[model samples]
Target: MKKLDLTKQEKEIVEHALDHWQASNLLDVDKVEELKQSIEEKGFEWKTLARYAFWVALVSLIFSVLSLFADDAMVRFVEKFYETPNIVFCLFFAGVAVGFYVLGFRNKEKYPEKTFSNETLMLAGSFATAACIGFLGQVLDRTTSHYTLLFLLSIAIYAVLSVKLHSKLIWVFTLVALGIWFATETAYHSNWGFKFWGMNYPLRFTLFGILLTTFAVWGQKRIHVLQPFQSTSYVVGLLYTMIALWCLSIFGNYSSFDAWTQVRQYHILYWGILAIALSLGLALYGMRTKDNVSRDIGFVFFILNLYTRFVEYLWDNINRTIFFLLLAVSFWFVGRWAEKVWSKGQSSER
Candidate 1:
């Protein structure tokens, strides 16, 4: 019905065979032989590339795991290789990153046919190396500013890697880096709970919450399902908002902390416990009704209740051992109920 377009070489091969044989309508054996040869050549090329990718991945995984245990030794190794001998630890990590790329380039030149695959794997290895170095800097308490920079860099790097590798698992590491940065910054401040808006963690969460809602709303209009950017932004934004709200109500109002007040400890305890119970009940109702805005608002009051309760037993009446025991028992009961509810949810999902 339809005619096939053959390349000049294919047409010549068919023509040559037709001249030698009494077969003009049948398939050409020469054409099939040429195809087989081409396939074998391409297959060999693909196998070579695959070997490079596999070895690179295996090496990266080994180095990453080893860095976790013999961290100091690895750091020194990088430092020596990089020649930044002062901070053997930091330099060593930096060197490893440099070396991975340098080796990738050298290997690419050596095996030109397998260049693309090896280069891709090398790039991934470089990211893992950088993330490790950044994490170590944070653990060593090099500086909050430095830690913040490292985590931000790691997040960006991993996000790009997700796109390049076409891997969803990379997103988990990106979220982890984001969470780490937020928590680290939150903890860096010397003040505890409910400081000024500029210095407060809740305010940060509130800002992130606003950002999430804005994007989620925009994304819902622009795209049907949640894109990677949308999902990441929304999840992180809600987490920050919730944490900030909790911090605000718990640490902001000093009057709620009866231990700081000159009131009788037992009177403070009774009032505080009553306040907490009412607020928690409201939060539960809000959650059940799917009133997110109301639930967020109620979370503030719930935090206030927790702070008051803590003050009553831990601070306000630290001398009252019986009250402390009662408080612990109450918390234990709540925890048990929570676990049961969570287990039921998991079972239903299964």
Candidate 2:
């Protein structure tokens, strides 16, 4: 059996448990000795130290660039590089992205256990890809705000790479690109107006999120390659939907902030009701269905709604001490509930 490297305290707990098991006749002496030999007491966590070292290296690299400019000769050299054409930058970043992707793939094959490093490399590649796309867009045109086309290109590139590599990080970037595309497309279509089809930005994003979530739920089984990412897509979609709903509760369908402020709080009571009701409903449904993501997000939504309402209606009328006391007590209850839920989950796993 592969040995485990555990801290001194962890090793002690394991040994104690093994001893208890032997006393209870659940494990024989030989089994207890075997279990004890299967673990080593570790004094230091080198993995964590390695990660910290990499972080310091990144910071040092940034400082090195800043320090380079402090030298007169180096500043001239950097200025000459800055004057390079956009197409050259596009090609350079494209090559850098390819290098990172190649290195990431090599690490995945050679040291599959180095999951964090592999993902970091892939993330770097994704960023380089974005930079490449931006520069390519600039190379295509010097004066045009049709950057939505750039986002479209980004979405396509990231989506293709994500599918090819089965990388969730790249998939997340694809979703981000999609969101940007949606925003820019709508804004451009509306001539950068506050109201698009008489619906505000929050309302439009809410609709987009609803569509995305519906598609995720509907296509999970049909799209084999995307099956693993279904939950991610669903949760992200629901997050977008829920955040937009929260904003709708606060701002309503008003075209401008000034107009919303001019209206009474009670005028948008229905929107708040809808948000809270959906949050509570989703929370209860998730608990019944054993969907942890939905349950946690729903609870957060419910808590945020409650706190926001209290701030809006009762902040001025209630005593400061009583208000804070109520918040503390409510949070305590929530913590206890969360503890019980986690305890139950652990017990089930054991």
Top-scoring candidate (TM-score): 2
Which portions of model 2 show Cα errors greater than 4 Å? 3-78, 336-350
**Range of the 10 consecutive residues with the lowest summed lDDT in candidate 2:** 53-62
- Candidate 1 residues 179-285, lDDT tens each? 66765656555343433345445445556665655665475347533364555555455555555555544444232355335544455354445445545665676
Supply the global lDDT for candidate 1. 0.57
Candidate 2, residue 7: how far the Cα is off, in Å = 9.7
What Cα-based lDDT does every candidate model obtain? 0.57, 0.87
**Candidate 1: pairs in clash:** 78-92, 79-92, 202-244
Q: Candidate 2's residue-wise lDDT over 227-300, tens digit each?
A: 87888789888988899999998899999989998997779988888889988888988999988888888889
